[model samples]
Target: MTEKPAKLLPPNPTIGVFDSGFGGLTVLRDLLPLIPGARYIYLGDTARLPYGSKSRETIARYAVSSAKFLEEQGADLLCIACNTASALALEDIKQAMPIPVVGVIQPGAEAALATSEASPSTPKSVLVLATTATTQSHAYAQSLNALGLAATEKACPLLVPLVEEGWIDHHVTAEVLRIYLNEAFAEAPNAQTLLLGCTHYPLLQPLIERTLAELNHPMTIIDSAAATAADVAAYFPPNPNGAPATSRFYATDSIEKFQRLGSAFLNQPVSEVHLLDLGG
Candidate 1:
């Protein structure tokens, strides 16, 4: 009698992704294709956005609540897609959660390090553009230095609000970006790489690129959200071999607005967004 070969079942677990607002959708945009078979539960806490200015205690509380909600929703793994939250709340969230929680900062730091390798000399000065919280935390700079790279970080607190308002091409946005970029250049003139330390900043990439061009500076701008997605792909377990193909979107407020703004970030229809009361 011949023995039958075992069949492989798809991974039933869903990956939970969180952000303070729509910014994290950019992370999801880059993530989905890489893990096409895995199910994703994306939650955007639009109700309490702009976590950048919030106190550490508040941000940590919100992060823990968000993670608990996701876990209740059957998340096997979690990714904190918000740079501000990742900067301020990652440690507390990790401690509060039973499952693995990844943050955007470390993955982005890894990507920037990889890019810096192109010019190994001078210890590779790098610039990080991020929210006030991220800049204040010095997460990118510390991570880069830990990896033996000289890093400069600047706070672009206004960038995310502008991006969320769908003002990427606005002249004001360009001017604001120029001001922040100038600060970065002044701090580290030899910087050959610019890390878009916040997910929302990628929406302004073209303008940022143009501003850099005008300065006659040709530095690589790393999109941290995209890099985070790459790291998530690498983190997924291979034993499952396959996973569910569906993705679900949830928001703490205005599912309609999320869908509308999400198109710009995800470059796809977010017609399936479901509203969440979150029982505040």
Candidate 2:
């Protein structure tokens, strides 16, 4: 929906969403209801995932390759749903593709600014909790500042692994969140908006709210996945008359794991995941 183009909607358009792993499905999950008429193609670069650890150049290469793949599939628009990719290589991917490529970080910062504006804060400030690579990129800080909202980014290195392990409701996860929030709050005491900067963090949202309540720090929690979905939805309206929206799942490797874990993220069973060989 974002980065408006001269022409939009090609009559039941194809939208491609790419993530390093299952996380992007969460973005797809939100999109399904909003844009029910468009066809969705989601590709998870699972075999080469943990894009966080890669260098900027390497990450750019991988992300561009993935984006080009989706473009080849006839994608009218692309969503870089992975925060790591969004942070480090969004421009690279954008340059390589002719389609509009929306990333999670900018939409998230804009959403946080909206939240801050609606709140009673004298000046807007945001506390972002994301993976190490995302925080390290300082992407959120730069974006929020550009919008006149102060930003504080905390790297929750353990959160991704714990979420991937399906320990979302576990006490350990809650305790870890507690620590991270407390640390972030200390850095940005006036921040009234908390941005979940990573896709994996959305699944832990309920627990995060609980942790915030327990800590007595009541800040508006912003889910970037949802924000990115809304941004994409801004481009088109529902096509109820045309065929129902259908989604195709693709992965570079681990079809079984993608189906099993992806369902949790998408909130629906992922059908036969086609194995794609986008090499190293």
Most accurate candidate by TM-score = 2
The CA lDDT of each predicted structure is: 0.82, 0.89
- Model 2, 1-280: lDDT tens digits are 3366565566588999999999888899998877767899999999998898899999999999999999999999999999999999998998899988899999998888787777754448788898889989999999989888888999999998898888999999998888888888888887778899989889999999898889887878899999999998777755667777899989999999999899888888887899999989
Worst ten in a row by lDDT for model 2:
1-10
The TM-score of candidate 2 is 0.96
In Å, residue 183's CA in model 2 sits off its true spot by 1.4
Candidates in order: C-alpha RMSD to true structure? 6.0, 1.4
lDDT of 1 at 53: 68
Clashing pairs in 2: 1-232, 1-235
Off by over 4 Å in 1: 1-13, 237-244
Report RMSD for candidate 2: 1.4
Give the Å shift of residue 238 in candidate 1: 6.4
